[model samples]
Target: MSPHDQHETPGIDLARLRPWFAEAVPQARAEALSATLITGGKSNLTYRLSDGGSSWILRRPPLGHVLATAHDMGREYAVMAALADLHAVDPDAVGLGGFGRPQSFLTRQVARWRKQLAASYTRDLPDAVTLHAALEERATAADAASRPGIVHGDFRLDNVLVDGDDRLRAVIDWEMATVGDPVTDLALMLLYTRLARLVGPEIAPTPPTSSARRRSSPGTRPAAAATSATWASTWASRPSSSPRSSRASTSATWADRPSAPASTASVAERSTWTWATVSSPKGGGQWVGPGQDRVLALIEEVGLSTFKTYVDGKSIYLRGGKRQTFAGAVPPMKPSALADFQRLAVKLEEMASTVPLDAPWSAPRAVEWDSTTFGQWLDANAATDEAKWLFTLAFTVIQGEDPHLSSLLLILFHIAGCGGIEHMISTTGGSQESRVVGGTQRISQEPAKRLGKRVVLSSPVTEIRRQDRGVLVKSERVTVRCKRVIVAMSPADAGRIRFTPHLPVRRATLQRRWHNGTESKLFAVYDKPFWRDAGFSGSAMTDLPVARFVVDNSPPDGSVGILLTFMGTAGSGPGLTWSDAVLDDPRARRDALLADLTKLFGPKAAHPVRHLEQDWAREPWISGRVSTRPPGLMTQYTDAVSRPVGRIHWAGTETATVYDGYLEGAVRAGERVAKEVGAAL
Candidate 1:
């Protein structure tokens, strides 16, 4: 079938299967097979193979669409199926019981929490800095003083069951349990004080004299239960305290992959492109190093065809969802974009390999990848100026800056292996990293618990003055001495702080030059998501000046619906000029947003019960969603922005090397700066 063919049989090749099935599974050789087409579409096509008496399941690649390793039938059926069976077996059989490694486990848990929180810092959280600063003294102390042993991470009453005789039936779910501080498990049980709140069937109260509470399943259940109760017995009364990129740290390789040949099959991915191949005999160079092995494994895991995402013109087709045909100038732009994507893919792979991610200017091929502005990069490769505008404008919304060519490359390479451009373009519905539910406030909870009374919430530090061998942190009615100080706010807010001795010229100049990218979230509140009934997936993008992206942020419980439209910086979005009063007026902003929304989503959108706007330009502490450098500014100040000045250090998402403008970057930057300050102290 041609790549353009819409008709599909989804029928299994019964003749081709006769020998292959016999080879793979000898038991199936005796059956004379017949197949029926069950279903087929963009995903895997299925067929029911029968031999009159019994049937077998068959699955194969879709006729036109294939997602490389994403739809791996081999791993899906062979490797995972067997591994899942093994996992279902008894845990004690695999020596999971009494896997005691106390200090190591607690230490790793704390480190993991810090790392996860760091990734979640898409926005600024200054309290997180104050909390993290006190964490080492607080979060780690509980581990050292407690008795280390086996503990269930969540020892809930609902996780257990009792029979009619009031006998212990089974103890299940050991996922969170491990050998660590046993006291923590008791803490979770104590927190679940309300018996009515249990997720399992209500258990009859055990008589004070009953020994039946000790019975459980398997050979190890009796011992496990006794140990748990024994550990819990000493924990009735206790004290409490709390809480909380590689490259840019994904192992996915763009520069590296298994260079293997593709079959001359009719599948769209392998049909046209002649993939360059290399042979590594039976035993190639040991697949060496932690970094190297991980890179190759990531390449294989994501699949060889992942790099060919641009080979088909499906980028637009996929992102458009049901609205496959483009209207107006979009159709014209689509043609040039397809060819550009193909060229960009090849060029990106070269850049991914040659460019040094952390310091692009230091790359041996910096002249090609980094020594140019992003506009220059586009013009050099693009066949037309319109192509340049299309990409440059889109990138402006993504990166928030256009100073260095590497900024463009950073966003490009990050999404290169993400299957296709559709995902990168579909900016609605949020992302996996957006799970930080309570916004920046989520960043403060753990820190508040750990820091306790030490966390001064409302006090604003008025002056940071240097004293002999220490610094004076002065706020309302307070003056505190600290050996080291970390300014975790934006460079703009940090600039508001008066440095008594004054920062070095380079540091001061950096603070003045770093600019926050302008952005506004046009949030519309609705009674319910009306778009779903109209077959809309709640995601859309457009070239219109009013809103480039619109997202359906419906509450999970269907209580209300919210739509967020954007007015990105770089003079894009809602066609509003940067006049102070025009941008500041809430009513004007709301009406204009409703008018634009009515054009896109119809009259229902115009009648939103409430409209909320968060212009980053108007936020007290944050002036922009991300920080960006002007044309010539980075070369002068890149090195000095994050440099430790005397006892002061800088940290924020913009300072990150990976996911630079994202929340993940902020968390990473926080951790890095915290370490830098800790070392000096």
Candidate 2:
């Protein structure tokens, strides 16, 4: 019986099975048997043998000439027995025929085919010779002591059957199984997964290539020979056979099977590809380290390309590539206002550079200013100070006028004492508290509690939509449904969350127009608070540092504390020794920062206890500092910022037009959104 003969063989008739059933098992008389040819094997014939009441699988060697070492039915039976005893095989699934039981008709046919196939092909043929060589190599490797196992030569999806629920019902065709290196099984499984997409659920009858056949043919058994050599060497050092115990140990090989879920399978496949690529000598080894090499090897073996593709597609670099150029190209400067703003920007930069390196009033100070007094200070200093002037200019360019300095000042004067100036004076006059300006109490610390809880932090949310019963927050995690969500984030964060049932077009439009003030903040903790004693306040608006303004963080008790600094705009560039490249390097970042601090606060500020920096550009959750509108955003999006979208409402600093990027804006947005949600509920 050749391979073709096995396929063409007629199945046993159920009607004629009565006599066989009477002799074999009288209880099986009521059962009928139907044989269906199973596909997916190159070296074996497998069939689904269904009795009237139950189904069983039959497996045997392929039709035609077979190699001496190929299609070992005994080895297959041993592996199945081990797996079954371990309960690794699903109980609902059937197993191979028991030892001593009469073989099924299908099995007899398969044996006949194996005999025929063995004689059909000659060793002279190139394909046959290659196939034999491959098998020899595999057998030699399998025989190595360290690689001992009952190897499953082929374990592709097509060889396995699943029930309606997608549970593995049976694994068929074990003719190529052998007691040898277990890694052979792993290699076969990996190969199967790679070819699965193209080959479908069934295993293909042909080898991947002639070379593969030579490497994998059973008679050659090169892997087995290698395994045997290793085993012999080990035994030479400490002699022991212990065949039974060694066979029992093979059960541990299947331990990994149950955990091999579909997702894991996909990841495994991708890892295999990545490993192959990286391990290839053509790819430079410069980037390969010990850990990375191991990872690449595993990835190659497992074929992890799919997972890698998914991750790369969602990275910040790809997502922000196009948007990063927006600020440079657009400049956010209107055509009519471009010249004036450009001139003001230059003047402000020059004035900032000319400011004294040391100043008494420049240090960080506590201020308790009413809105009116703050407004008065702004009015008095707006024109003289370059920083304030540039701010006002930018505001005027974006907004038609500065309402805070104009209309809001009058309101503040009526309600409190004087306008912005008086308010600033009052706040500055307040007694200095502990050095740290914004303590833990002032900042939300909820994140601290969620640590180590599988939190998905830092990933930017692309969109949010409302579901039937709850809201869906979509991040890298699949859509998460939440009944109540705290949008206690930035306005930019709020704007990005897409709502379902459509947020009113007005609200969506408002969100796009609102801007989170893009500013950079830096904090440097020095060895001691030395600047205060030198009559130099910690705060200064200077061109020496990247930040336009710095705050003195010296404690009243004289302990070393943090000095906070802020860049008024995103385009400050680098200050002193701080180049763009240095700022990006973690170690250089701190050094560059300290270099600037020393310039402003004198030599004593050269070394800091710690350095902390924040770049709003790369921060996903809070893309920018707070909301700073272009001149007209307030009139446009102010009313709609906190408006409700069906049951969902918006909240964040950007949503608050009154104090857009300030802490006050956050509070305002929160209060307003809470009320809106309350009303909806």
Candidate 3:
């Protein structure tokens, strides 16, 4: 019998457990009580209970036998209680709520559920065995050290709840909580997350290893026996005993092999919910739904051949021709992959490029602002001097030739007035005037330095043939081999550059999506610093465009100046190409911006001396904007991006940790790449 098929055994009753709760928690009588079982997970049974208006959760060992160290309810309660105390004071710390002592009645009830699950398994699942073995080995190998407080042994997502506001309301399930190694608790949490994705949310109790069971003597307490019995029952209910058809057995056998391809079809057919396949080329076949021609056409359009050798779901196929699985891991593609895709996507983009770029055309939206409240908000959120310095570096380079120098000076003056420079000097014990002057000089020098360095800029590099001592940078230019080559470019560029011996997909993916910042930088220059005279600082009033932000750069000299604006929308790339001619024409659609600024400030703001702008789209040497990240790409590819490929190392704004999109990011990238290159030597 499969664990799912096993008959449920009667265990302890909730009514019996209620007395313990009532006695232990004096507040229970005043609270309304309700109980519901949350299914999934082997070894422990978890329940959610509400007392009066307050919600609480309970957890206990599954019915029958369990491993001795597996489910220690006492430890879980202790840890949560300790953490709660800390959480009350420090909201940033990882802490959960109130805890209670173990209840014998609850323990018996959980044991019964475990027994049912263990007994239900009619056939053995080799995959389950392998996974258990891996977990046990990892646990044993980890250092046996005490952590801060109690560890939640089975800390899976279901055991945790988020309220309507998306705050983690509570963490329940104490059966596996312990005072041993905190790493073990972390491991268990990770294990549960994996198991939840593999099995349904309701987990079947796992049988303990023979060594674990033998270690538990007859003198074991009821709790220990309950845990052991659950494990034993689960082990006894393997699926191999079932009289499965040859086809069913074959399918099971294939599934048991970790390397075997999961069905790349719809949930209706395979009954699997995996985002990996959904985003993959193999999964693409299922999306076309029997339309082979359409599937083939889509494949051709996407250039599936380029992705055949990649892995981690970004690549279409992996070794052994299996569709890469990205579920529960990072998403399939890296930022670099997207960059490469964008490169390929350009061909398609060009066909549509002729179409007029769309912009919202209407009178500027009105925003009500309370001056006092707005001032307080600024004081609260204003970047520190360090942050401002970093921001200045970042924003300056993107400002290019037509930066609003006067506006920058005014901003600096405002900063000085706000005691920003003074604070910086006091913190660092440096000369305030010198620091300000130095910072200003650095900002002024950045744009010219970036544009001054002229190199043979290449795009879509065909190959980077490597010799023993040097690497050849092959583009449209004749191959130039050097003792070393610094591939301070995008990951897509690095990936396309072929090594003498081809680099691994891991290395290639690292290069391509190394620093995946798809952010947008927009510049809107004004005729003069009219806003300042009107009592409005250059800063704007919104947070739309996600990262949409504006800075006032009206020249201090009262000359024509510019306001640099950044719109952080993924689709906002086309806006970079907005030229002076486009904005200058009285009949052009954007002419109203001039009118709006004039009305908002004064007539002098009607036309900018020169309205210069750039969207990351037009930047060829640097693809995309600074390295803003999506959810999972950063953690997944961090190490890979850091690694060097052959004699070729990479340095780009995206590679920098300190100032990723800023000039600081560039400097950091340079330093890191230099270190890697030096290390290789």
Return the top candidate by TM-score: 1
How do all the candidates rank in terms of TM-score, highest first? 1, 2, 3
Better of 1 and 3 by TM-score: 1
Worst 10 residues of 2 by lDDT: 275-284
* Alpha-carbon local distance difference test for all models: 0.46, 0.38, 0.36
Residue-wise lDDT of candidate 3 within 1-681, one digit each (tens)? 323223322343555555666765556652235555555444466544555455444556678887675566655544444453221232124433233222232233244444655667788765455434333322321222123343455544555444344344445554554333444345554554443333221111232221111111122111211221111111111111212111000001011112322222221232221110000000000011111232233334433311110011111112122223222212244455434433432432332232221110110210111111212222343334322222332333232211112122212222222223223222122111111111222332333234321112211345666666555544432233344566555564345456677777776655554433333343446555555555544443221221123445333344555565443222222122233443333233234444444434456766665544443433333444433332233334534554666665666544553323333344456656666666765
- Candidate 3: worst-modelled 10 consecutive residues by lDDT: 276-285
Best by lDDT: 1
lDDT of 1 by residue, 1-681 (tens): 332123333444455556666665455532466555442122444444545554444555457654443344442232212121222333344454444467655556667667768877899887566545444323343454455555545454443433345444333234344557765665665555422222111111221221112222122121111211111111112223322100000000000122211211211123121111000001000111111222234334333211110111111212322334232213245676657755765675656565444654454544344335556666667775545555655555554444232344444434432223343333222222122222333343444344333333333456667656766555432244556666666666567667878989988887786676666667888888776665554444555435555656654554676777666434332222233323444445566777756666768888876666555554444455566555444544546767777766677655666555554455567668766766765
Q: How close is candidate 1 to the true structure, as a TM-score?
A: 0.47
Backbone clash pairs for candidate 1 read 118-667, 122-663, 242-449, 242-450, 243-450, 245-248, 245-249, 246-249, 248-658, 546-574
Displacement of residue 3 (Cα, Å) in model 1 is: 99
Model 3 CA deviation exceeding 4 Å by range: 1-461, 493-500, 511-527, 543-548, 554-558, 568-589, 595-599, 602-604
Q: Which model, 1 or 2, shows the larger lDDT? A: 1
